[model samples]
Target: MEHSHKAILVVSFGTSYEDARKATIERIENDIIAAFPEYRIYRAWTSRMILSILKKRDQIIIPNVCEAMEQMIDDGITEVIVQPTHILDGIENHIMKDEVLSYKSCFQSISFGAPLLSGQKDAETIVHAIGKRFEYLDKNTALVLMGHGTAHQANAVYEELGQLFKDMGYPHIFLGTVESSPSVQELIQEISNYGISSRNCDSADNDLPVEKVVLAPFMIVAGDHAHNDMAGEHPESWTSRFQNAGYEAESVLKGLGAYQKIRELFVEHVQNAINNINE
Candidate 1:
């Protein structure tokens, strides 16, 4: 319960997967601390389901925005900056904003930072980062980046980014979502239009356009969705759909947070909020 005049509350949806939590979320937090050592860093998770699961199963507790803010007030912290690790300004970000704003008067200054795909520039930077990360792939292989889609209007960001991936000098790199448009099925159709086949059949008719795909999670953490919905053996999973559609599938089981560039972008987001608070 120590007090620091300035603090950065790093907020996320949170995951119970120990390895993913460590690789993505914890690494982002560590990068934030390294970038802004002067300011104390705290953590908050918006998902009540995840929080409850962690508390009951793992015996770990992470505060939500309201609780964290109150804790800051109790500890005599004045200025506050909240930086969400979400991919877009969707339902989760909206919740964080509303809750964080409730305690505006409790701090000298309060600022909220942009999420990963905040603006055009962020998207552009992300494009190159992903391109470089998967540069090892050849023309015959497709990269299907799985994103956690939202019900909110912000869900459009995924489709927008989907278009951005097309012919942006990153060949056959596509995006799919679990919730909305540009779903894996939709991407299947799109990929079909590109003739990126996965058929390595054993029949006499072997003259097929063969291709392999690398599936990766586009979200900050490769959690349940990455393991279940995206790569799970279930017939409805993206991996199965791709396989059923006659394409070979390989899942990367990695999240955006594992990349240093993505982590650095998050740190930049925190720094941006800090600068805005000072101004």
Candidate 2:
């Protein structure tokens, strides 16, 4: 039997960190490519606005999913499967899904792969991924993760990640959102209070210096937020805020997606979605 699948579309939210974004997308694409060598892999970016801004600055070329689909057809592809590389069911994934639906009439079959972080299994995989990247400092330092929170119900997924860290036995893990609950200031206050609480609770026999902390973004790429908000030395940035609060702070520029385990999670997501296509 001849398998006539056209291509696997890997849709991402598009990152300014061009190399980093390509690496992450390629990791997932390679997995699908290896599994279905007969099917071609097409890449699509969901953030047209971001890509447009990058294009104006000569940063990146804006990718169009429709055009890519049309190209696949022109190349003699008859069946198409879109695998979104988004982390959540947010605007990016929604936009990609809508775009894929628009081409349903053109293909014999059109299916979607799953998002990176979706259900409990996905959350656990992400936690495992993050865990493998960092060893506990033993400095009683709080690890704060800044996520791109949204107004959608999926924003609650951030809390799930917080709980995952808690369940992993991390003593002090805090979740902050760039756009929603537990705002940056709120996170700073929480960290300050935690430091104060820790300092005041030390017993005479257990003398320990004020614990230093590390701030890292929970995003998929070390893009603008990671660079400007978390790691930047600006007076208003998280690193500066932590220093002003009398606690040492450092930032890890790598996002979760850059980690190998995290990359594997996306592969699992794609595999599961492809397996479930018949169901």
Candidate 3:
């Protein structure tokens, strides 16, 4: 490997599921490595619970932000750039940023990248990226994205992103949270309104009421939230609720990190942070 004074530390909330852990989080890290080959890349998990579970069950050991930073500093890395895989500027991301900043003096320059939804056009960009994937859906289908909500004010990011999708002329797309406002009931109401509106419209023959719904996780990893809260066969899961309400519902068990364009956005954020440090 080529010796470099700068290093890139990718931080994530992490997942316990090995398949999801590989498909989403590891894929994002790999993309970052390809983008900045000159910089030594490292990964750190913010979720101590997940990390502990992985260690105990699978014999997998992953470092936290503090430990990763310590290794970088010990290796004489004078410049370090921290890129987070969080989807929003919520409490988790905020804590990650603070942790990265705590090791500032250990390096000559330390820069932290913004989360996925930080920039003005991020929402629109993400909407387009995900929208393109489900282009085959007809007017009778609704897309419901389940996000991990937060009490932090940044929770509004999900609502704003959903609005951006609507503003982009995709009204059938709905956003719901696992822990905040715009709950499942709210999503049902919104989708029901759209269904009613479609039925009332006397437009062309192609126009039809939404009788089918697709549920997906608007999260970085399709772990517990996606597997249980969003798609589990439980009566309260989003898929189950949608089915119980009369719409044929199915869940896509994948994360945003599975998308190429989405991973490119994280790479862009890392570049932006590095550019800021250079400036």
Candidate 4:
């Protein structure tokens, strides 16, 4: 096989769910491969727990970012681009960037791609991309997105994302997180305050005013948090609460990475990073 002097390392938090990995992470990787046929591509995961789980349960072996970089340097690949699948400039992304930078001297050059939602325009772009995923919802149904929020100050990305949806005339679209601001209860209250709740019923045809609520993950990959926290049968899950509240709740069970537009944004970010390297 022909070798390239440079390579692209696709970094993700990784998932134990093979199907989700295919639908989201792999799809993004494939897009990157298609765009840069001359450059070899590699995969690295950030979540040691997920990597360990996959190794034990599925016998899947994937390297972490540092390991992948060491392998690349050993293979004579001198330059690298590290593209992450994180949804925001949150804790995970910051750590990933730091790790990649620590290996900068090991390579001739290294550039890191921005997270999925980076700047203000990216927030708007993602709102439109994710919004397109739920065009089927009617006025009587609320669309609630569950993001995997971070303890980092960058958790404000979710807040900004939610605000963009509302500012763009999608007030019925609510955003919540499993580990940060705008919890499910907070989003439910937002829905209720918007008069899209059973308590504000208007007619039997519409039933509970807000007859249904579509729940989807706002994260890059719909792995553990998406399944167990957002859609699981557990009483604490988002689906359970909405169901108990007399609303028809449905889970999309897909991540933002599953969307074409979202992937395009990542590709654009990679291109920007590559351009920066060229400059």
Q: What are the TM-scores, per candidate, against the unseen true structure?
A: 0.93, 0.87, 0.97, 0.93
lDDT of 2 by residue, 1-279 (tens): 675556677777777676766656666667678877767788777667777878888756756787787777777776677777677888778877887788788777777777877788878777766665566566466777888888888888887688778788654777888788768788777667756666787575432334676888887777888889777888988888778877788887777666777767776666666666656
lDDT of 4 by residue, 37-123 (tens): 988999999999999998999888999988998899889999898899888777788888888888888888998899888898888
Using lDDT, rank the candidates from best to worst: 3, 1, 4, 2
- Which whole-number lDDT from 0 to 100 does residue 51 have in model 3? 91
Number of clashes found in candidate 4: 0
What Cα-based lDDT does every candidate model obtain?
0.87, 0.74, 0.89, 0.87
lDDT of 1 at 53: 97
Candidate 3 TM-score versus the reference:
0.97
- Model 3 regions lying over 4 Å from their true place: none
Tens-place lDDT per residue, model 1, 1-279, is 554589999999999899999999999999999888788888999999999999999999899888999889988889888999999998889888999999998888899889999998889889889989998987668899999888899988888887887657775789888888788888888777666333544555333343678899999999999999999999999999999998899999999999888888888898898888777
lDDT for position 145 in model 3: 95
CA shift of 277, model 2, Å: 2.5
TM-score for candidate 4, please give it: 0.93
**In candidate 2, where is summed lDDT lowest over 10 consecutive residues?**
202-211
Give the higher-TM-score candidate: 2 or 3. Answer: 3
Model 3, residue pairs in steric clash? none
Q: What clash pairs does model 4 have?
A: none
Candidate 1: list runs displaced more than 4 Å: 1-3, 196-210
